[model samples]
Target: MASKSAKKVNLLDHNSIKHILDESVTEVVKNQGYVEDVRLSNAKLLIGTSIIVVALIAQFYKKKFPENRDFLLACIALYVLFNGLLQLISYTKEKNAILFTYPPAGSFTSTGLVVSSKLPRFSDLYTLTIASADPKSISANEPVHFTKSITGWFTNDGVLVEGLFWKDVEGLIVQYTKEPKKSK
Candidate 1:
């Protein structure tokens, strides 16, 4: 009877120890996977930013030098095309949505307005409309009157969302009108 009792105690202790070890291993694996994902995401963002910078520089060169304008313009076009394609690839791989916040009142003109935002919720669709008193002369860096409207749930409080409509310009062009929440 004493031997049998001892055997049962040893078996239970062994099972308990095995369970703890398994749990610890699982936790470690999960944490490592999360870290790897974060690193990959950061790398992608950096690559995208670099491409955009290069494209901007090429555009500036195209505009500033008229004698070599053709060459610079070609470079600018290629850069924009390549960077856009790369951005699309990254977006598809990450399954990330785009977010854009409207600009505050009194800070944008029809020519100067650009909108962009962080990744939005997968289910949300954002539609932006640009209206101006004079529509024909709309271009970046030019001053013109405009109006914008947006519809979405505000997720983060106090975080200014940045966005770009044109490839090069960045700023707030419209403001959101917050609706009151209904009491349940």
Candidate 2:
């Protein structure tokens, strides 16, 4: 048969496959940043709103209790101090630290791979955990075709990644291994 003479060829070349995987991984990292920002933003909004409400209440009732004005003033001062401290720490130290810790050994899946060394904590002092399930069909450390569908989350000191495929992750590692090509 004429069809028998045709041999099966890979639909994607190595470079194209790599490019696709890299883009997928980049998307995941971007998503992670967006999620982290939302969390931080929500926290800041809550703190700012609480401080404003309490300060307003204290000012409104200050005239009713002339003798206790000092106490209310002290409370407002403490609230402001707390807000300042949080901003100082968050901007100075925790600014860039709020990123997803990439796996160093090149994780194909969650199994037999280390995700993070130092766990990050929330403002509420809760620890975070990142979890990703390994594919049953793939062997440990084995590479697979990259397709981005990993759903990860931050839950009380944890991150959950579902169906972690490595093709999407290779981009993160490739930078470390190869130098960028410079244009002449």
Q: If scored against the real structure, what TM-score would every candidate get?
A: 0.28, 0.34
lDDT tens per residue, model 1, 73-179: 67677777767777775675333212212223364433211222222233223333222223364322323222221111111331111212221111212221222
Best by TM-score: 2
What is the per-residue lDDT of model 2 for residues 95-160, given as tens digits with 9 covering 90 to 100? Answer: 433343333345443342212112222121212112222325343333222223222211222322
Judge candidate 1 at residue 133 and give its lDDT: 21
- Please report, as a residue range, the 10-residue window in candidate 2 with the lowest summed lDDT: 117-126
TM-score of 2: 0.34
- For candidate 2, list the clashing residue pairs, or say none: 127-157, 128-157, 128-158, 129-157, 129-158, 129-159, 130-159, 131-159, 131-161
Question: Which regions in candidate 1 have their CA more than 4 angstroms from the true location?
Answer: 1-34, 59-63, 96-184
| Pairs with steric clashes in candidate 1 | 99-117, 102-174, 103-174, 111-139, 115-163, 115-164, 116-162, 116-163, 116-164
Model 1 lDDT at residue 17? 30
